[model samples]
Target: MKKLSMIAAMLSLLVSTGSQAMGPFEVYEQALRNDPVFLGALKERDAGQENRAIGRAGLLPRISYNYNQGRNDSKATYLNERGNLHEDRHYTSSGSTLMLQQPLIDYEAYANYRKGVAQALFADETFRGKSQELLVRVLTYYTQALFAQDQIEIAQASKKAYEEQFQQNEQLFRQGEGTRTDILEAESRFELATAEEIEARNEQDAALRELGALIGVPSVAVSELAPLAQAFQSFPLEPANFDTWHALALANNPILASQRQALEVARYEVERNRAGHLPKLNAYASVRKSESDSGNTYNQRYDTNTIGLEVNVPLFAGGGVSASVRQASANLEQAEYELDGKTRETLIELRRQFSACLSGVSKLRAYQKALNSAEALVVSTKQSILGGERVNLDALNAEQQLYSTRRDLAQARYDYLMAWTKLHYYAGTLRETDLARVDEAFVRR
Candidate 1:
């Protein structure tokens, strides 16, 4: 079993590099087939969907048939006036019956039908929430991998700059134009950069592993994202009202809606239990054919037919019915509390994501400016080095700063996208169509 589990895990990590490029939505479609958690929810949804039919069956007529074939033997002893007589007989006997019963007035069954509808609705909402959650999860994993890849690039660029600085310092020292201290500092910096490069590469690999696990692939490479300005400018977030978003969340959030259904079903349970004490009426019909033996030693066959209405009036039940009603009522109260809790949580999350999304635009702009300033600083430092106003080390530092700022800028863009998606998810407005614009934001690598 352990080996099989390992194999499954390994298969989930297998990568198909030859396939066409896959984005967040494309990967999610793959996860729908391979993600175990989502698959389990799908099965549960299908099973819950059967509740309506199951409940309907209870309100329909039930028909049954029975047949029997066997041999029967009999022995008899009798004492008369002055003599005793014994007789033995054996025969084959067969019987068959067919019956149908229909409930005329069953309050509990009616309540059950209502409960089934509510339960199925609850399952629907739950399943929808799971589906929306899949998009968020896939996007998160995909972006994280990209972010890790960026870090590695930054580290390698820094490493290269430091390597050049070290070589220059070493040559200057040999020519007596630089001090030994300069060479030592440059060498240390290069070594540190190398270490950073190794660490960053490892992080990138780990990130890819996580992305693979999510999409049931061993390895993956995400396409490069479009420049922030082009993407955001083309598709800007508008009508940023927190109250409006919160209202939408309250109205449509699947988790909260599912909880609402739960509460309704609980109310039905209380009704069903309360109705248990009410009288029940049913109509029944039956027909039977049997073989029998008479005292005269002759076999006979008979047919019987029965039809009647049955009325069951509850007189007393040792308080069991009342106790059941109380239990159901308590459960109903609990469901009400659960629904309230779900509503509160959904509102809180909606506010958080909405705030993030609303502010993300400005945040991206600020990060972009920061990256620009860093790049300008690197150019200015390089000119200063040429003029002997700054050393090679100063130019290298400026380059490192530029890359760091760029990475942060990229991170902010991704954060904004994530917040946007999560806000829609909270509002239960996320769909596959929402990804179309986002997909355009990725250029094929």
Candidate 2:
């Protein structure tokens, strides 16, 4: 008896521990930390920074060295005063030269360096935007997991209710008080409830696995989500127009900033193309040595060194430089247009999110009322069943209705949470610090 009691106590404790383990927020945080997409963005941002440094270095002078060696043979004819033509012997010559050159004046290099710096800044903004996107994905999946859990609970409750009713009908039928049809009906309902419970349990498992995969912890366990009361203690609402949201989005959205930077880059590209039309000055130095030998004739050796500045004036290039400049200018215009289009789109998205949030608030209130009504109906149907009325089917139907209402309420609550997240994200207020606020509200002990 003592061993049996101890085993039973341990089992009960295990069940209790399983019921109140970690919450969804913790899981999502862990997942975010390990997300591959987020990590990739971080690496890409670092690479962009390095590329920017390379660009900045382009403003400095460039130097190069060169060497050459060759052998040459030639024959020449000479005419003397005596009118007798004499043939000059062929000779082979070898020469090598070393050269160093540096650009003294180049406009395009400077413009490209500046563009690289702007692109680096844009990369930083893109990283931040990726973080926000990951946050949304994690939160959405976490909420789905919680909803699956709620469904499991509802299924369990319905299964228990149906089982009890089946047992009672079986007893009544055995005593000749209930018809066999009544017993069969109760049995069928219980079986249906059992099947639903199994399916709900399977759905819960799949949701948990998906959540685990998303957060990069395939082995981690998920605890039930806390009740909605703890998740939404206070609703923060502010009156704001679409203009306000547009301003925030334009100011804080990484994609918009990147587009602006792209325009700057395109403008610089145009400048770079125009620089092709200007004179390029370079300083250069070269040293050369040569040796020549004619068969059985003579041997000669020579060395020469020269240093000077060379200026290249592009008199003409088949109009290529002009065409390149025009193309760059057109790209700059397109970049500007893209920036404007993105701004308008962000503003529209912000307005839509705000409207959805407002709608969710009202929907949650209606769902609350509907839940209460469903609960009252369940209670009344139960009483009728106990008072010897033919109310089994009605009671069962009421129980199902109550579960549906509760599920709807849960959905509304999740929608409100998601809408709030979207609104904050659009407002440029979604940050790590803001996540703590959400954690406090949505994560319970």
Candidate 3:
């Protein structure tokens, strides 16, 4: 229990310190340090960098030194003019060799080196795609948290309006001017609003926790969006056409670029496997020194040096090389198909987001007008009640419509902002500056 309290206090401090209201870019910076996915990409990039060195090693000079030592025991018997003679001897022998080999014309090694180059390129582009994905993820969660907060605000406002209406109806009943049925209806609406408010709060908490988990914060609260009137003025689409966005996605989208590299890697893989059936050539040099005893030439030392060119011709590999080449060609075909699929998918998403941006602008305008109309209806309904043209229920319904319209208006604004960001993201132009621009739409609440 004591341990739990300390954990709770630490989390509380995290929330309090986060009171400064983090924008998307701020959260992204934290994620860069703490998010495991992004960190793993960094590590993968580092590991990929070694491929170049490893591939070049096959073409470079290779040197090695080896030493050997051994002991020998011998016994011999000989017959002489006088009698039989016996002799026994024990001795040690030692030898050392230094060797060097350099590839002169190895096709397989050359192909392998090229394959490594392509693999490294693929890894680099893959990491870039992951970086862009991180940006998208950060913005996604930030906007979700903001939307949840908006829901909470709208729910609270509804609950307050209904509560006031209920209280007014109760007073009217006490004065014998309102019916018991009217009071009961008001009571029911107020209770429903209260429940909605509770649900909205739960949603906001869940959203905050999700965002917090992403950025290694606990119970984070996002900075609220600036009022729509002020923020909308800054939210115009750049280049403003689906064609330009399509061109940009084709030219710059990191995932597409990475897939292209992957295709290149596959092509190189086919070449690498095909080269296995080719002959190899290498140049070799070696120096050796040896000393031996307990032989006819005992107590003598020998030194030798050699240099030559070596060639190896493949006769049969039990059809392994041919099979490998076939498999690699199949893989290359698969990569091509995958790249085609990705290209189509990317273009489809680009079109979808672009359409959203175009529609979002008109939707925002329509919702704004609807919100204005709803507000006017509430006022007119109240005035009508005094003129016997409306009832207490009419005013209550008008207020509810006003609140719902207001919520829709807010949601439209969020959708507009997100669409604009996603457009840039799909076009591969999303950057820290773009996030900063998005941040301008937010202010400390």
Best by lDDT: 3
Model 1 segments more than 4 A misplaced: 1-20, 32-37, 76-87, 171-196, 210-216, 222-234, 293-300, 314-327, 382-397
Candidate 1 structure quality by residue, lDDT tens digits, 1-445: 7466546645543442234355666666667766777888898899989888877887999999999977777877789988999888688877799999999999988999899989988889899999888888877777777776677777777778777878888888889887787777777877777787688677767766666666554655444222223345224554567777888888889999899999988999999888879999999999988886344433888889999999999989999999999999999999999888888888888888778876777787887788889989988997898788998768767877887787777787788788888888889898887775666676544
**lDDT, candidate 3, 1-445, per-residue tens:** 7466446544654664456555677677767765678889999988987787787788899999999988878776789898988888677888899999999998778877887787787788788888888887877777666666677777778778877888888898899988888788877877877777788777767767766665554656444322223346336777887888999999998888888888987888898888888888999999989888337645679899999999999989999999999999999999999999999998998898898888888887888889889999999999999898998999888988998887787777777777788788788888878887877777754
- The clash tally of candidate 2 reads 1
Candidate 3 error regions (>4 Å): 1-20, 73-89, 170-188, 222-230, 293-300
Clashing pairs in 1: 13-218, 14-218, 15-218
Residue-by-residue lDDT tens digits, candidate 2, 302-415? 788999999999999999999999999999999999999988887777888888777887888888889889999988888887887745778778877888888888888887
TM-score versus the correct structure, for each prediction? 0.83, 0.75, 0.86
| TM-score, model 3 to reference | 0.86
* Candidate with more favorable, higher lDDT: 1 or 3: 3
